[model samples]
Target: MSMKHLKYCPELNQITGSINATILLLQLEYWFAKMTGGKFYKFLDSCEHELYKQGDSWVEELGFSKQEFRTAFSKIGKVYTSKKAFKESKDLFNGKYYASYYDRIKGLTYYIRNDAKLSELFDDDSNKILYSEEKSTENTEDVLRTPQIIIPANPKTSSPLSVEYNKLLTSVKDTHPTKVCVPYETIKALFNQYCPSYPQLTLLTAKRKTLLKKLWYDMGQTLENFKQAFLSAENSDFLSGRLGSWRASFDWLIQEDKFVALLEGCYTNNRRQSQFSPSTPSAPKPHSKFTTMYSHYWDFEELEKLEDQYIDRQIAKYSTMSVALD
Candidate 1:
């Protein structure tokens, strides 16, 4: 199935998870509209884009009158803007003016081009804004030229991971018969995301079951805490196998003392200390051809700075050579 990139702010769900269903839909619609048409459409006078049309005609196309559109936008905007999570995070709306439009187009195009059967939570039918074939045929060529974006079809059925997760959840509840049960898939997804370099381990394993039970039940740590602790372990040079063959694994994460230490930020703080302090003299370890070295902490900004310095040096060297030739 094809992937149409949608302008999704994941933090929106996090911030507004408890909001009313109708209000949630209103927010989504506003986000979709803002994504298709530029936010500058709100102030038509200053919009420099050639594709931007004058007046309420553009707004009308979104199935909302001027007043209704404004109200919808305002209501959702207030909900999100008031949220600390939303305020702390950045999204398409935070960057360039045209970001929302492009994101909406990509997201729309994804569903249109891909298979249907998306999850009920994010069904494609809910996003039926436009891009019908009859009109699409006429506007296909110009659609690319214009500011408009194609809203893709939704394949809002069950995904393999979701099915597996749900199945696991039901099984766990049945077997344990407990009042408290952690969502395995959520924690698994978080681990995969935050610790990409680590080996992909499944919670369905016997060892993993024990580990998760310890973290979730025995410790009473929330999913968020587990995620942070996982990140901490991943960032540790010693624990992640950077310094030696001894590296922490999924099973190691649940060790009673180790897990408690990680939760207390001891591991993360130690890693930070190592980064800032001068390296101490130590015995050199044997290195094999297969022993791959990775950065202890890779920072994008640091890499960018190094890249800029390299580019400047190249430019200066080239200028000197040109002068010599002259």
Candidate 2:
């Protein structure tokens, strides 16, 4: 009970009342948000500095044939002091918490590019194959129609992402294939990630969902229509590159007397990845506040975009409902 950082508790049963969960989460969120301010991006910059330094400091110590860099970075990140303050977003694109936090998590699992140059200048093309999804670059923003949605103060209390996400992965009614949308349930995994030090039910409420559901039309259609809305969500997203993963990993860092680098086992040849964990020994440097702000500008912009998308979704839902009733 000294203070739990991030711990997983499989046996931690889901809360019975959504209201109870919502209230509890609201309390925790108050503190978490307070510590993670508008300057969240600056925090990511600091994380990068640490990753770069740690990677280099422990490269020789790891002694892997390929020279494991993430492990070193993870070890250092796990012990860093900041992990005790910020809480990470469970899903980066759910349009909830900052995107940079989400990017940090994916960076640990997938070696995504921050910029094009991060790709290797390999002597042979055969050596540089990454089984990544083919990125579609067509700007569909023009074809976009305003989507309708119900927004409550908190998605956790208002929507159950766990329930909705599970269904989205399955085949929807065969008749409706033209559109696809994400519901609150699909995003539950993010909210309920196990904090290894002390895992428990978040206890968020469903009132937000109830309010939106009544104010809006067919919730299913709202989610379905969102397919287009969310296409570039993870891409152009403020959390798109360095800040994304940096933030998420940083989120895991907060709340712990000791931090564990979840990315310790990850490997990447990407230059940004390498730079963040440069495999050299150097002392940590004091970060300039401006540098931190620069890294997170996208976060502020992304959150605004999400707010816009939510309003648009509500509009779309309104139209569809009227037509159906007519």
Candidate 3:
């Protein structure tokens, strides 16, 4: 029989004390099974290891959110930095062997435990264990034969660790929809270059990160769009603090409504007015009433002249009709 599905052991939950960790362990076992030359004692030396990248497609394939995956992966045990020290027998786990090692450049590698309690679950012999589909519908006990543990009538109250674990699990279960990946540092750099006068973004807090990710996704997920947004802010008189004391900052620019307005040229400079002009200024010219409304495009003075001519023609036609009637 071909090993098509992963067999889950209830003992893993007992060992890890978490359902998320149990699921991750099963998935990791599935991956390890695919490695060539068979499983061995030490990680990166005896057995082949897989490098797990965060936010990879396999994470979703295993039905885990990013946060859930991270939490579950951490529960496995300490991740060693040095491969030499990790290979040493003294550094290995004493009783139940479960180790993880991480490198900054290469990424994360795991070593699943191969203890007697869970040995049968990881066995190469596929026919020994019954898959869910092959199991008899009458009883599930045949498929999962978990050893019964005697519990006291009055179990001890939950510990702080258990409470915190429960909270983490709750957060994992309540996962938000995956966000579009945004180049946050690149955007920050662009903001710094373009809006030099505005408040600089030194620290990217959790709230700011959330806002930026949302903005990047909403704004079509392009660096060029971000560039244009920054440029628009740079050219704006009000936003650049030329028109007012209050100036636009990174926080103000990322707001959806405000960003949309900025792109629509709402806050842009109306004319090419200089910031610092001569003390002797030119006399102000009289402008049409509609000047403020159409100042960006139309010549309101010409519009006023056209209106006067139309009124004159209408008056002349009415007088000519009255004279003919008389």
Candidate 4:
């Protein structure tokens, strides 16, 4: 099963507990940035908040004590520069007594995007584990063989799926809906990309089709938004796990609040703006007028009592009129 956090690292297999905790802590930091649409530099910023405590909680969840967590971070400088766990790259940040910057503001991003180690952990099958060399060969072949269709440079204006979407769909699902005569190949491609272990979507199930339709028409998210969210989830350690693996999924992501939350960078270091502060900002909120203004103010309990009395009076008047007529 896919894990929301990296529970095991081959490098930490035979390391001291302190070193293991340190490496795990670093991975947790990376995972935090991945979930949020922000960079890891935010973690190293001067701003102080509960982010460290949150990391501690994760360490505790991973079967380490809070003291160990604290000690790991405290000793990070000594251990990291010692060339113990990860070898220091030639790239250096001009800080006193520091070699490679732990923040890795740009280098980490470059690696995650380019380095094979950070990208795909296991194959799609979830059964077989391929070595880095073998995986690289397969990836190269897949790229060369994939159809070189040019995705529109400005997909937002065109409101169309990206080249990545087209390649993913043609490779996997490739469904064409007959009833609507409007093929939703884009949605199919997203589902396939989001959940590759599922059977190829030659046809979408009724439930799946309705969900896709509402996500597009009701939610009003374009194919580009879908593509971006898919990539975000793909990189997130918490969301890309297979269904029933305690990680978020495509369906969860499509929810109104969840989609907006992901897009807003709630999970990322961009959330520093919402951190605890001495005084809260008085920014005007959306729909504030709706909450502030009301045409009439009636006490709910009084209104209910008045309504019941009016109903009784009407019944009595109707009874008297019937008697008089009789």
> Highest TM-score: which candidate?
3
10 residues in a row with least lDDT, candidate 1? 108-117
Give the best candidate by lDDT. 3
Ranking by TM-score: 3, 1, 4, 2
lDDT of 3 by residue, 153-235 (tens): 11243332355654754564763358567788998888777665566778887878888886676555788877777777876
- Per-residue alpha-carbon lDDT of candidate 4 for residues 248-276, written as tens digits (9 for 90 to 100): 65567767557655553444421122322
What ordering of candidates by lDDT runs from best to worst?
3, 1, 4, 2
Superposed by TM-score, candidate 2 places the C-alpha of residue 31 at a distance from the truth, in angstroms, of 3.2
Model 2 per-residue lDDT at 307: 49
- Stretches > 4 Å off in candidate 3: 1-12, 36-57, 94-97, 103-112, 115-117, 120-127, 130-172, 175-206, 209-326
Candidate 2, backbone clash total:
54
Runs of candidate 4 exceeding 4 Å displacement: 1-183, 194-203, 219-221, 242-245, 268-326
TM-score of each: 0.29, 0.16, 0.32, 0.24
In model 1, the Cα lDDT at residue 126 comes to 36
Global CA lDDT of candidate 2, please? 0.26
RMSD to true structure for each model, in Å: 20.2, 25.5, 28.6, 28.9
The better-scoring model by lDDT among 1 and 4 is 1
Clashing pairs in 4: 36-267, 36-268
